[model samples]
Target chain A: MHPHDPEVTAAITALDLFAGLPASALDEVTARARVRTLGRGARMFDQGEPVERAHVLLSGAIRIAQAGSDGGQVVLRFIGPGEIFGSVAIFTDHLYPADGIAMVGSTEASWARADWLDLIERYPRIALNLITIVGRRLAELQDRVREMATQRAERRIANTLLRLARQAGRATGAGTEIGFPLRRKDIADISGTTLFTVSRTLNDWRRQGLIADDRRALTLVSMAGIGRIALG
Target chain B: MHPHDPEVTAAITALDLFAGLPASALDEVTARARVRTLGRGARMFDQGEPVERAHVLLSGAIRIAQAGSDGGQVVLRFIGPGEIFGSVAIFTDHLYPADGIAMVGSTEASWARADWLDLIERYPRIALNLITIVGRRLAELQDRVREMATQRAERRIANTLLRLARQAGRATGAGTEIGFPLRRKDIADISGTTLFTVSRTLNDWRRQGLIADDRRALTLVSMAGIGRIALG
Candidate 1:
């Protein structure tokens, strides 16, 4: 088996969903996964594309999004290392319901649906893992739904910042610096607000000494205060 | 095997994720499922309960919701017959993230975690189906996220009516009537808007001859126009 390949082994091992699988199952999974490198701004898949494989983020970032009829786009979620996307469409036998684009230079690992299905049949643990993964995603979406229904735009923005900080933040003297490379529009997309609103809110937060932004980096000044806003 | 018992079958079949399991597998499933009845406005599970069984809706409606710190509640989704809702916490190993309440008199089917895992082992098709079902829910959440980010309140209200009409609507000469028993607050909860906003939008639609609400039943007078508003 080519399971000795470092990249394949690394990718499978990194995925938290596959944590409990035996080494043998890991080898089997790696054998079926095909690794591909992507460049920034590359379209990984378009809306309505046939979903033949599930893509896992091994390195870098990918944005799952939808373009509306009004020429506007919405960013659904940003996938980072160890996360799997496209598994849903692969199982459903339908075209992808959304589009994915590379947010940075990235390496993605993918598995054919047939091969993955075969593995799921062979390993029930993987099935459980998948269920857990999907369940977590559903819970996250439910949270988002709640936020959209009840929370104000500024509070939603604060919650988004806090969530991102926890997921991809780096430590600095100022606070946890969210280091993900995101444009203001990308932030707007993630937070479910307009770019103008994002700009205005950020400016307001900066004036109030809650946050500071430098290029793609944002440093939180008061996580406690941000939490208060999110609770609103 | 008691397969003919609608309560048993309904709970077992509520999950599209568990479809295609053989009778023997289903019998095993039936052993673990508890049938229960709830009165209107009764809480099936609270927001912070320890989630042990995946609750399957048999008859009547359940609102999966999140309560705001300010004592407001946002209904995330309405659960109907042949649908599942409590699987999210099972997958995440977290406390119940939302409260589920019976919107009307209701019956439910529920299964323990051990039985759920056993079924996954015995029937691969069911596992795959669950994956697909969760995936579709994720896609729907993505759509909602988009609406919250870019769409205005008017458009959100329009899209919500279109969605509810599709979900619970019945045909009539006036138009497709959303027959589900709903309060203005429930509509507001589902549409992610304030009750005031929902009231104003409905009034506007009524005045413009686009919709008619007689008690709890909402009739669409102009679907095409509603679609235009939703698309914007």
Candidate 2:
């Protein structure tokens, strides 16, 4: 809650959007933040809610997802700490298009929409940073669209696992483990496949010594094996 | 291309990116534009090429597509008159991720990357307009991701047709005619289906009096029918 709280300040400074600013500018940004803490499995915001603030995750993970009226969901992205989310809607229509659900106990800082606009106008670097972030996403989504059209389920899942590993993986003695509670539903949603298929494929990979998992986190035991499958 | 050429001046002013600029500012933009014309089936740019210029379509149509190394292609978006393409890479990496291919005889105006940056920096409204455009595309792509995960092929095709019509439709007595030569291959690429599936589905819709088409264009015969399928 305090602007100068060392933990909050450190996290805020680590963000890519604030990368080049001097200490004074960082202080100005830190002062504008309103912090919120989310419990695991709780939503930070729901789809169709009125837009209010632009958020940056400080700690833990968030799944940006949308559910169709017909019941299935798509995981648009998984947000890690020191990353931005919930800002896109502010630039478009003033409504959230997806839910920001905390997959773990997470804390984030948000600036009111008016404040965000003002900051970007003053610190144009922030606007450029935001644009770069969105552009990267556009490219990734284009790749996903191609995979959906051409690749089978196994290849899609393999690609998803490899991508997730690159994004949030941490080194472990056994292998590189994805650093959060990645559920089967998330894997299914990201790969555009069924839950049953996700479970079965992961199990098969486990049996072949390609992966390792516990109740919460999964690790890639053989990145080469997954890469081969993804290539196919 | 003379900056004050009435045709070029009119076309540049009609663009949403230049929506709020004064005549003087529009002249500046027009002055920077280098015009190019494409023959039917010509490529404006190819995937992985160096990003040189940002383009705005003046007339005719272009399909932005990416081809996988494995030989399948995905149509990313169909560009209509006054639409922007090949600019996202300017904000991300300096390489194009898709090929900009003319679907018919086409004309476009482009600005060198440095000039485009100078313009946006000099005119912040242009920056905001660009953000709004990319934000809108992000929303559409999210909805598409959801549909890919949840909906069947027929629904996806219906949605694509409706979206295309809304983007580039011209009203005719028979219906709203898609304002370009939308090929069956384009439909297959956009809808994440096979050529056989797109042709079969279009034939089925034609027999049911849901749509009408000639050699070059498709027209919506009963928008309500297509809307019904899209809703599912």
Best by DockQ: 2
Cα lDDT for residue A92, model 1? 62
Tens-place lDDT digits, model 1, residues A109-200: 88887887788788877877888888877777777777776777888888889887877778899988875677888888888877899999
Hey, what RMSD does candidate 2 come out at? Answer: 1.6
Chain A superposition TM-score, candidate 2? 0.96
- Across A70-117, the per-residue lDDT of candidate 2 in tens digits comes to 676789999988788888889899899899999999999999999989
lDDT of 1 by residue, B81-156 (tens): 7677777677676588788889888888877877776666777777677787777777767777778777888898
Displacement of residue B65 (Cα, Å) in model 2 is: 1.0
Docking class of 1: medium
TM, every model: 0.90, 0.96
- Candidate 2 matches the true fold with a TM-score of 0.96
